[model samples]
Target: MTYTHASPEHGAPERADDVDDVARILQPDGTRVSDPALDRWISDLPPHELRALHRDMVLTRRLDTEGVALQRQGQLALWAPCRGQEAVQVATAHALAAGDLVFPSYREHGVLLARGARPADFVLAWRGEEHSAYDHAALGVAPVQIIIGAQALHATGWAMGAQRDRSTDVAVAYFGDGATSQGDVNEAMVFASSFRAPVVFVCSNNQWAISEPVTVQARHPIAGRAPGFGIPSMRVDGNDALACLAAMRWALDHARRGEGPAFIEAVTYRLGPHTTSDDPTRYRDADEVERWSRRDPLARLEAYLRDAGVLDDSGLAEVARAADAFAAEVRAACIGAVTRDPASVFDHVYAEPHAPLERQRAEYVDYLDGFSR
Candidate 1:
């Protein structure tokens, strides 16, 4: 249901700040713009950590590129490309602790990579061999949610439990710009605020949610919606990895400290088509794409690393080689994935063995056996 008017008790629809002026710590050219006194708190990450983030970003892109290729080659049913939002996903993902949980929207390839989801896990699922490539317990992440914004409620409920346990762990809900319009997301925020759930609503506002631009959905910034829920909200340049990492760290810290939920709207662009089947060129202008291309997160971070002398030409060469190798490995896995038996799809439909499900599984078995005969 579209929320035309929130309750008056929420207070005159709390005035929204100009989100275009939201705080940002990193420039497109890798220049720092954060407060001088809080330099260490913001961008003074350990050298090794920073280096690792860069590599992970590159690897994420390589996986994304290969995933698209696999889909085009008919190895996978469909693919959601995360081409332009790598920095947002990688930085926010790395900010979480090992025990924290993540509920990702379907296109969270970068987050899945940061959470240690291998190429095999992704390919096997896309190849229709399994329900998902990830094991929740091992990865500390839930299965990808395709039913838009449903995971927000899950995250909120999980965060309530975490809060009761008095644990520092937090629950993160990752969704796209379009999710804000979902009733599930709004209801989740309402419950989270009322109960002070320890969750962070991380919205990757990549400008376009499929064919609909963000402007078509909301009149104000998505972040502004949180204020009405009594949750602290902020916007970050999603293309700036450094800014995203710092913002996520701060938001996680707030939730971990029992300060209730936080909301982050990451401003980014989607460089590729929404999915393998969607054509973005029909609705989007070429000039807009070109403008955002100049702000490519990887190139920005690459410039920063080179400018700061953190990486030399040889180091850059190694990164390129590593990306290529990683892509090849993913391609091999996708091609080698085995098809799952059709009956297996019904194996876990009912936890306690519902009679109807059993009948269906049996019928499926009989159907497959007939094909063999």
Candidate 2:
């Protein structure tokens, strides 16, 4: 969603459709804006923690670039780039407690990393080396869901389970603006509302859903849809790391406190193609990309940190070096990944061995033996 400054000091939406109450704590120019309602959530963060957020964004971006490079090099089948949506991804992940769970779409690499997934775990699925790259149980994250907004239903169901168990854990569902139009997402919201499930719906409205613009699918702010489901919602400046963090913290807290499900529309932009197979240039204008580039989340956060004396030139250099090192490690890991046995594909089909699955697995192995013969 676009916005117009109400005054020289603050940004205010010119129309209700623009989400008149969108929360913004940092401007594109790196100036900090006071958000009375949301500020307290992140007020206790120290300079070091703030710096960590910057580091995570830089690292996540580096990982994304590496993924694209690997895919282009034919090392991986495909990759989803999360270039400009780092703030929303990283901040929302950080908002979760260790006990909380996440059901994320394919593009949430930042969230996976934040939740303790290894670099190898990020690429194994893309490489076709494994059905699932990470141990979801250990990470408290579900396997990456590629079927659009289906993860929303999974999250809502899990939240209902947690509610029944009387656990404080919140289930968070992360998807793009495109997913909002999906029936699964809408149904998930309805169920979550009816049961007062402890879930947070984070819709990263990154302008485009693949080649389709958000404007094409929805007439008003995506956040506005939540009210109809009896869910409290907020629209936030996804490019502003602090604002994203604050909004996520607020949503998670609300859910964790048994306040039912909450929704967040993070107004961000995708600065790259949807995936390795996508050609964004065909649909988006170069000038539009240039315009959003000025609102680069990483750059503005870096600027804010530097201005606040949290990170000087040396510190910034250190972060760059660290990100580079991490990316190199990830690259090496992806390139040298051990290929999984083909027959092992049948291994995780069910929790325990089933007669039909076992018979199929045996037949599959026999077929492989025939190939050898």
- Give the count of colliding residue pairs in each prediction: 0, 0
CA error at residue 323 for candidate 2, angstroms: 1.1
Over 3-104, each residue of candidate 1 has an lDDT whose tens digit, in order, gives: 223324544542222223445666877776764322444556877788889988999898989999999999999989999899999999999899999999
**Could you tell me which residue pairs clash in candidate 1?**
none
**Best candidate (score: lDDT):** 2
Candidate 2, residue 240: the lDDT equals 88
Worst 10 residues of 1 by lDDT: 1-10
The reply for model 1, stretches above 4 Å from the true place, is: 1-20, 36-40, 350-354, 370-373
Tens digits of lDDT, candidate 2, 12-117: 3233225325789988989998988778999898998898888889999999999999999999999999999999999888878999999999999999988888
**lDDT per model, in order?**
0.84, 0.88
